[model samples]
Target: MSNRGGVVKTLFKRDFVYTFYSWGFYVVLFAAFMISSFILKNFLDGIREEDILVSAYPLNYPLFISVIVISIYLVMLSGVSISREREHGTLEVLFYGPVTAGNFLISKYFKDLCLGIIALAFCAVYFYLVSLTTNLGFTAGLVRALVMGVFMISCVVCFGLFISSLTGRTRSSVLVLLAILGGFLALQFVHAALIGMEREALSTPMLYLRETVSHLFRGINWVSPFAFLNRGLDAVVLDSPLLFGLNIFYAVVYSVIFLILSIISMSLKGVKA
Candidate 1:
């Protein structure tokens, strides 16, 4: 096989062995699936209520679950990946390889991202199953979600690798990662507050300010991975599709930029083991 092909097999084999055979992996997979299924079932049943039916909308279900599953997968898998290597003392051992720093980093990033992508695929499956309950259908939404999710996963993996690279031990890295992740999540609530405040301030003659604020929110949405995923789907999945080609172009462009930064960051940081 060619060198690139060999690299592909080596990475794929390593990840499959590590993730599929590990008991911890199975536990996480089972729990996520079971909880997701239960929640979706409850949501479907709840839609029968008059008030709930009025609020029920397409992609609403997907958005709710995506945030939970994606966040957990990113933080937990990253922590677990690095912590396991540190526990086994394998990270230091791998530093002696013929692999360049870039190659090693790419391998780790790819492995983690693949695990996340696979999990997200299962998330998509759960989404499809739930959609069967109503007249709702999914196709374009799925494509955009998958594309955006992968891009986001790539970015998150880079963030995780940077955390892992900070020290020889994984515990410290995991703690720092959780701290950062929590802070980012809290920012979303802050955004909500800011938007509400702006609405009140612009309640008078500055009617155009409302539109300007809304447009600003849409533009700023590109920065957050979760925001982009939610916005892209929300814009396309609902009966009232808000974003068109221009908005999608913006999202795709941003994803590419984030992914490039991720690659560069990972390349610069060598894998110790």
Candidate 2:
């Protein structure tokens, strides 16, 4: 095999072996399927609309489930990847090897991405099957949902890799990953509240605030794999719609930037080790 082929094979084998042997991966898949199934069932019954609207919650059920799933996966994967290696003391060995920082990080990241793809595939397949059984056909909303799902996976993988590179301790990395994700999410809410409060009769402040907050929310939603996938699925795929132009762009750029940074950080740290 050529270099690209070799990379694929190596990454694929790693992803397949690691995820398959891990109970966590199965739990993720099972959870995703159950969530999607429940959501589909609600849609078919048409009663979901009443409950959601009556509650006045901003999130739809499927979107909410996807966000929770992606966030959990990202945090869990970050700790597992680094913590396991640290426990085995393999990270020190690998650092001393001939492997470059970029290659090493990429190999590991690719493994995470592959696992994410598999999980997302499970979500897609379940939705499809459910749709068939219920006579509810696939819609453009689902396409948006899947696209967001892929983007979210990429974001999570990159974030996880970055966290993994920061320490040899898996627990520490997982904590940091959770902190970063949670901090950003909380800040978005704070931002919306701040903006919402700036109303005045002459300023059209509330109107501007609402639109501005919505835009910011969308921006963050796209940048975060967890948030973006759900938003895209809800707005673009299922209900009141919005396109993810800048959100998509930001997400891709952020993932690339972090992946590169993680590689550089690992490379420097590896040299010291």
TM-score list, all predictions = 0.68, 0.74
Model 2 per-residue lDDT tens digits across residues 105-125: 677776777676767676667
Candidate 1 achieves a global lDDT of 0.58
lDDT of each residue in 53-78, candidate 1, tens digit only:
54434445544466446656665565
Best by TM-score: 2
Q: How much does each candidate deviate from the true structure in C-alpha RMSD?
A: 5.5, 5.4
The deviation in Å at residue 102 for candidate 2 is: 1.3
Candidate number achieving the greatest lDDT relative to the actual structure: 2
Report the alpha-carbon TM-score of model 2 versus the true structure: 0.74
Model 2: weakest 10-residue lDDT segment is 51-60
